[model samples]
Target: MTRHPGTNRTAQCVVCGRAFPLPKLRKIGQLRPGLHEMIAAEVADCGAESLICDEDLAHYRRRYVEKLLAEERGELSELDRQVLDSFEKGVSTVQSSAASVLDRNPTFGERTADRVASFGGSWTFILFFMGVLFAWMALNVSGLFAVPFDPYPFILLNLVLSCLAALQAPVIMMSQRRQEEKDRRRAENDYMINLRAELEIRQLHEKIDHQMAHQWERLAELQQIQIDLLERRGDTQRG
Candidate 1:
């Protein structure tokens, strides 16, 4: 109950047992019921009239959110942990650039596979490969080559096509695997951003509700004081 010099009034925090100015203290009653329950679960002696400093209140708010998330999800994943950490730190969960996530300094082989897969899927590669096949057949069948390297059956050409297919399949698969990994990371990032936004909105709603409740209480007190003053005036006039 010791007052800070020059301050009108001060209240001591029940959790931390540190005195703070009235403006810096929050009543347990003003908190949302869920948040109050969280604090009470930790501090057995806390009640509706108990005061908590803003810092302790913030800590309990974070714990309440963490408990809510854990209850809803059961087991927290790495992504969920990251979201909670960011929420506690009051930092943004949004990635600065999504491309940075996709481009995270890929290895030489990965880059090459991606490029090969991309080219192989394009019309340019298809048309060019078709033209090469036609020219090889024309050269062998039209007697353009003195002794055809690949004869009418074109066994050598068949071998080359088979080799190309074998090499291309695995490369495309590797590229696809890398793409799937990138997509998974992007999804995690999106989820974290969305979760952060939702937490912020919930906090905002809690603050508005707290303010409204506090205002109503102040108004009720003022009305009671006015009624008391009017009663005193009536008694005085009657006298």
Candidate 2:
């Protein structure tokens, strides 16, 4: 059982098969992912793995856990949502829609990388650079229909092109850097989604095991009761 340090609301976190919230603890839950950005700069002064695990998993199971996590991480699509809604037979239905999202949830980095890559190799970038090069080369070179607006390999033109490239390259690099940052953030969201899913999955497994254990315990208890009843009957008969 994973206990929440310095607390009483023992984690019934059936996911990792741990009980928690014992004492001397703090909980960092009841928060939305939108609020997570502000948290990026907040540092935990001194804490061990157990406390980290407790807080991380607690938020994983709070209200709207699956939906909020999936939506924020860009894992849930409209199509998925439609299918999920249809699965419900009533206005109030079981949480089976995402019952397995966490169980089958993928790693954040992996999923986000796949999505970003799907945008197709920043080819717009390559095309833009190529267009600039071709235009520069053509305007200054003698060729079809062009006596060369600036004459073959114009020195002044080349210098101008060089200057433009120098300026443009840095801007392009800056744009690329910003793009990379976006990818990194998306990847982080995916990771958190994956983490929450894995934790929830572990809890589900724990729930199953707990139920099975209790079933066996209850069987034993009932058997004892039956035996006692039979012995009492026999004693009365003998009496």
Candidate 2 lDDT, tens digit per residue, 106-176? 56754554445433247885787679767767756636544556665467668886997786565556546
Deviation of model 2 at 174, angstroms: 1.1
Q: What is the TM-score of each candidate against the true structure?
A: 0.81, 0.41
The ten-residue window of minimal lDDT in model 2 covers 86-95
Q: Which runs of model 1 end up more than 4 angstroms from their true locations?
A: 1-30, 44-58, 95-103
Model 1 accuracy (lDDT, Cα) = 0.85
Predicted model with the maximum TM-score: 1
Per-residue C-alpha lDDT of model 1 across residues 1-239, encoded as one tens digit per residue: 32345655876788988878888887897788888888888886788888888778767777788888889889778777778777766677874345586767998999999999999999999999999999999999998778999998999999999999999999999999989988887887888899888988988898898889889999999999999999999999999
Scored by lDDT, the top model is 1
- Evaluated at residue 116, the lDDT of candidate 2 is 50
